[model samples]
Target: MSQADHRSPQDHEHTVHYDGPSGGWGSLRGIARIFGKEWATPAALETLARQNKPKGFMCVSCSWAKPADYHTFEFCENGAKATLWELTTLRCTPDFFAQHTVVELLTWNDYDLEQQGRLTHPLRYDPESDKYQPCSWEEAFHAIGAELRRLDPTSVIFYSSGRASLETSYLYALFARAYGNNNLPDSSNMCHETTSVALKKVIGAGVGTVVFDDLKNCDAMFFFGQNTGSNSPRFLHPLQDAAKRGVPIVTFNPVREKGLIAFTNPQNPAEMLTGSETPISTQYHQVRLGGDIAVMLGICKHVFAADDAAKAEGKRVLDVPFIEQHTQGFGDFEAKVRGTSWSEIEAKSGLSQGAIERAAEIYVKADRVIGVYGMGLTQHVHGFENVAMFVNMLLLKGNIGRDGTGISPVRGHSNVQGQRTVGISEKPELVPLDKIAEQFGFDPPRDKGMNTVEACEGILSGKVKAFFGLGGNFVRAIPEREAMERAWRKMDLTVQIATKLNRSHLVNGRTAYLLPCRGRTEQDMQASGPQAVSMEDTFSCIQGSIGLRKPASEHLKSEVDIVASLAEATLPPNPRLKWREWVDNYALIRDLIAQTYPDEFHDFNERMFTPGGFYRGNAARERIWKTTSGKAEFTVPDTLDAAGFDDAPGRYRLLTMRSNDQFNTTIYGFSDRLRGIEGTRQVLLMNPDDIAKAGLQEGQMVSLISDAQDGIHREAGPLKVTPFSLPAGCVGSYYPEMNPLMPLSHHDQQSKTPAAKSIAVRLKI
Candidate 1:
């Protein structure tokens, strides 16, 4: 029987509607609910007004760029929700912590724990009392510093979140290096690291080539493994406009998402009132999970076939001229495409040859094509190969250096791009070691550092002694959560600089400190009056953001202030580097960044005042290939069929996904209105055929066992099975909840990113 047939009113808090256009009154209702849950109408309205403004704070949601031309209401529903959540007046004080023990809090799910509210002050974990008690900021810092000094620098790991501003990120790297450590891991390491690794090899740049304006004018756009409506709602505006302008959008994902199919702009009053929706994807191809590489190859094969046909007719359809001048490896790449059998492509991609041809026809007909992908493409075992395949497809048409053509990876986190720009990478290549030593008067380490996955392994292996996090739930976000948490307990000290309490805070070491800091919604008054921090968007636009709302608590410190103070306590006085000056005047930090990266960030402080901020120059954007070959080079893909990895009996492929109600590790609410799930985050989305084959009923609860080669125990669930429209042999589950099923050692070889999108599993009914 179908899940719906057995589902009772008590089984779900709300009915699950399978069909509806995304982003209409439904989005408005969701926004209203956020305000109701977190803030009063006045506070919500005030916070919404300030979001994404040039003079105000940037939204803490996704890192999609703001338009060059500013709109009054630029924020999306989730953006508004994030602003409300951050600016909420509710506080979780020392008394709240005193009422709960770490062991008791560990039993609470992620949402319930964070929903308690914003942390008001610094706290230290007391092992004797089994609870967190209030502690002074100075004492907290001194204690952390003492521990840092007690251990070897190589034993300490510095982890950064994308929410950190450019100023704070720069300071963080500087502090880590000066204090004699090079182990820097950031949010990028877990999400877009594959993009960085793949793109830099082909284009000599780790970031996307196109700016936000490129989307408005692009002739055709291809979305691979990305749900634009849920992950980046603000990005849908340009897409909606593109559709209205008659541009064809092609989407390739496992599930047919409502956002990609059609969207009614909440910003448009007429559309919202009349219920008129803009159809987004002209052609939607539901490729199976981990099938992106095969699908990309199939499309390229069709493009080649068209090129040969056009040549036979004495006409050039492909950009041969541009390709000859700006790209390399066309001959070998074309040969491979020709050699790739249509049957293999169809079998691997789970799409018919006709469908692939149809999408290819749309791509070939357009003068300029833009490729956009997200974690869905980059969170696989062959993720680096997957991204390289995308770049290869773009290079075939000479799409990298044009008005409306380039590769754009939809990066997560508001400042994830900025974090990398300001040198939060485990592999810091942008700024040379000699130059950094010369500029900052300190010898920076040249060796590559540990990534998120490697950092986890380091801790478990006893190589890492101390762990420090700046604004992310590191323990909860990574895979093999239980093992990582157990390893974390072995640390000499753990420090978390955060705005709110999360699962990471509860996963304590012998000595742990929760240094509550001011969120982006709160005003940061440094020694030099009010300050503004700059962040780089996915499109490489750097803009200033200053908070206007009052501080959540008087005891809370700004990120910049906290980092500066930590540096003061940890490192001996370095006359050459004035931590206080940079902390007090954020402009000074930008000036230093300009000094460190003169070519791209020249006149950085002055550029902040520009209307939408300046675009950091991209070599590929101008058709100047900075690669070793002096041209974009096509690389071969590792696997045409990701399903080949499942060679064992009773194995099924699983994809970990974010619910519409969640952003990254933060669960906003239980209901995923877009996906039609309500009041539960533990449901497993599966195909009915798969459910039947496994001898499981549609609504039956089931446990998932990982097919990890390491022989480690990794499992999750008692997850409610909701038979959906996934491809046979594939299942979907929410992330962070399903994170335990991911093995620490199972990651992309090139990038060290956990293969969160593709896990081999077996159903246990």
Candidate 2:
């Protein structure tokens, strides 16, 4: 029976369609509501004005590249929310913790836990009393240090979030290695590890090659599995300008995202005065979930066929000479494309041959193209293959290593890319350990450290005894929530350096400490004077960020100070590495960074203050491939279906997504304004056809059961079914909430990123 047959007439009565453009009055209203709720003080307004400006702090939101040209206000709607969220007057003081026990706080949702407000002081979790008590910084550090000394460094996990500065990340990594291990698992493991893993092997650089100028001057821009509206709205401005200039902006995703369709720039007076919105995407293709690899194969097939025809007519299509000189494995890739059947391509991609040809035509005609993607292509079993295939498609036309061309992976956190560059990675080879050892007077650990998945597995099995987080809710962000939370308490020590209270603090271990630290929007005073820290954006531009406002709490220390002090407390004093001097003056840390990575950070301090920062300079842009073959390589996928899910009769491919009101695991609000969802987040979006096929009614309550081959039974319950425009076999739900359904083992074989985007599931009433 169809869902419509069982549905009542009032099922969609409360549903209100959002017909306006992405950034019109809707975004203004969103900004205003956040200000009004947070009681926007003059201080908050001043911080917002200074955001993304020269000599001011970067937005603590998405890692979109800053423009060379400055704007009157560079902050977006979500960026404003992130700033206000940090600048709020509400405080989660010791008294607040004293009133609510950890047991009681565990029942609260993620939004409520963070909404309780910023952490004001260092706190120690008392398991016997079931409450967090105020503790001196010295006491907290000494106890944490003692615990670290008692445990094996190999069993300790030092997890970092992308919100930290480059200097801080460098010191954090140094501390871990100094303590005798490289067990550094960070935020990148969850989102874009596939981009790093795939691109590094093929192009010799893990990060995107495109800069702001390349994106601005590109002849055409193609996006896959990215939602510019929610994740990084600042990118929409460039897309809006490109649309006005008649550039071809193409998008491929299951959901017709509002951001990719049209945008009304709130900063423009003319756009605000008129209700008109500039069209963003010239062509939008709703590619099936996990079908990106198949779609790429089909496009390549069409391109090869077109080139063959062109050769017969004495014309050229593919850049044959460029391919021969700059790339390897093209012949093998072409063979793989030709071997794939049209019927298989059509079935897997869920697109007709004509549609695939149209996309290929766009690629063939455009002289310079920039490819943009996000976690959607990276959070699957075959995620590494998905990224490699995209690069292969671009290589055919020589779309990389030229002006106005290259791949741009839209990073999530402000400094996520920078964190990796500064050496917050599990792989020791990615950084210059020999230089670090010489400069620091210690032999750094050469062994590969634990990534996020391995760290979680270690914790679950009671092998990892200590957890130290620099700035994130680690327990809540990773997969296997129930299992991790239960096992988390059994650990020996848990330490979180954060700006606010979170569910991670509530899920305390035997000995836990919550250390409050200064945020990006607040001034960080040191023994020297007002200081600035450097951060690298999505495009590898390393810029200085100096906070100008008073901190929310005077007791809060800078991340640099906290890390240095903790290192002092833990490790025996090393005369060669002056931890205190580094904290007192950040320039010392910058100097050491320059010494450690002479190639990348040479003259780091001098160029950091340059307007819009200086580019770190990607090797790939100069056609200097760092791969073993000394040239860019084309990779062939073993299978067209990346996820390799079974075609069971009652299964649907589920892709976890984020709401407009959320960033990573931080829930700003319950409303997802772009999709017209409000008041609650416990809802599932599915195609109307799929809803009918499942015999489910619109707004019907249902539970999702995982179809993973693992023996573990995982399920996420009581989600309201909402009919939406998705593929017949695909469904969408918010992430972290749906993270429970993802098993720890269900990750990419190469990158080990959680396969959150392509989980096979069955819905039950």
Candidate 3:
């Protein structure tokens, strides 16, 4: 465990180190720094102790689930940081906004804006004053309601972030429908929409089939496109344990992240003292950007070929019984896999045939396999296909319903899956409008609403008159910054329910309101006597969370209260669903949710308190496929070609990534400690040959220009080029900052998730 040479805050030098393992004494040092100074130790320790604990506040950083019987001190480095970030003592009061105008704040970076700290009260933008002033909850709600009522309900967009609790999200969705529209676009649309879209078509379930226990017992785990060590650090403990138990962990990613190579358990005293780290990734394949489908196809091709040869020698390699009994379209899928040539796979995937063959051999040898992936697999042009192909490969051996095998889309957001489960969606298929209408006594809107991309278009085109964000930095999170800013300016009304000030708050609409909400770690004192909210983990375990700390501010409202009050003020009176009652109890919200999704969330509150919460049973997990075909199906796209990056010479496939120090739009620091990047966030990782081919030198100032069809060439840079170990023709840049280069039109055809990974760009040196 080499020590990270972190320079003073004054240093602005671009430092890049090639080798460093994640989560050793390095993580411990980070934990000490975060909890020691800024957060002042005591409060930070209390919050950290509560995170992910049974009947405690859940960490809203990532959705990785801990097993029912978990270790006592269960948290990762990033988890600790997230806890401190939320539980910070700093306050962003009305005086803070008064000190800096919106225009002035816009000039500040995302980190600087958020570091101003927790919003102290609800505020309404006063154009005359040119500043945010404290506004009473009633006055703000009434004003927003009046504005919303003036606009067509269909013209309003309600966006939900994954941070909201299931209880809050259910009320949010109910509020949207009761207010006369179902235009609910959420954070999921940006990240895991492909997982939902693809899995539903293939396995009849939109989410993963495996639980935390399944992962622990899996013989082999295939991590595709997910950097678990950075994104979900606690997952490293399981991977290390699996390695210790002789279970092979295979990884396929374009960048060679040190987190995937080796991990030192910060929780273990012996490992930390001895500087011993567990080596993960028995096999690492640097598959090219947007080439996941081809690589998966190549692996399947090997499996089929190996099975044929083994059968010829009087041996069985494939699960023929499972394939015959529980799956459909295998013949067609097998034929297509066999048809793809090794040359095409080698060229497209940037992986030699031997690597893919070896991965397939590992897959074949394992009795029970778990497939895990993150945004890297789901943020591409072929994102849906990438997800489906993994399912197709797993279904070959009937891995769906078993002790340790199933699909796992490791979500980055804590309650992203929970948000969707409670009905935060733009599409109508997931929302049972009839049930909602009947249960709530209103004719819910039946039309499909705008997704995140479409919402931007709607706002820009003057179709969406009002945009309400129930927690998210929409401007920073979305692509086309200028266009989104312009669109936001065009909206008649904009409302953001947030914990702190972000770039989205600074980018105001014609009439903007910033409604401050309590952070996930804060206590909620409701009429029902200190209410507790529930959040479903990525594994669909709905666990209860009760905040142990005081509210950031006395004026801060629960998201449920904000949404309920806003709904009451906006919509016409409806007696059947008493908004106040729902807000007061929350258990009533669960009851309503049960009414809406009876089959899955039946006896809602009753089953919620059970030891580790209840798992929403997936039909696919039980090998009872609920698809139209009544069996698990293999669906292949027309072609697995990744064709955009080759439009011209010097064009490279750019993947937008988050620094280890950051979590989604929120920038924690300029340095990415594990990556050896210090004192800067403007560094771009590129291949050495690609840099030379583009006539660019290391640390050269460069602009990344995207190939645009709308006449406006999108570009973001003046970024320092840093050559690193990456596949040829592929480059990496930090996201949110690089989001401008990603066009709004560039998205998955099926899921409409912005193609954040496969951008074709040329360097402007």
lDDT of each: 0.84, 0.88, 0.84
lDDT winner between candidates 2 and 3? 2
lDDT of 2 at 256: 74
RMSD of 1: 3.6
Residue 716 miss distance in model 1 (angstroms): 0.7
How do all models score by TM-score? 0.97, 0.97, 0.96
Q: Which candidate achieves the best lDDT against the true structure?
A: 2
Tens digit of lDDT per residue, candidate 2, span 285-371?
A: 788888899998998899899899999999878989889999999989999999999999988888888877877788878889999
Please list the Cα RMSD from the true structure of every candidate, rounded to 1 decimal place: 3.6, 3.4, 3.6
Stretches > 4 Å off in candidate 1: 1-17, 642-644
Error of 3 at 647 (Å): 5.1
Can you rank all candidates by lDDT, best first?
2, 1, 3
Model 2 stretches with alpha carbons more than 4 Å out:
1-17
Top candidate on TM-score is 2
What is the lDDT, from 0 to 100, of the residue 244 in candidate 2? Answer: 86
- Count clashes in each candidate, considering only residues at least 3 apart in sequence or on different chains: 0, 0, 0
- True-structure Cα RMSD, model 2: 3.4
Query: Across residues 24-104, which tens digit of lDDT does each residue of candidate 1 receive?
Result: 888888888978887544866876886787777788999987665767788987887788888776788999999999999
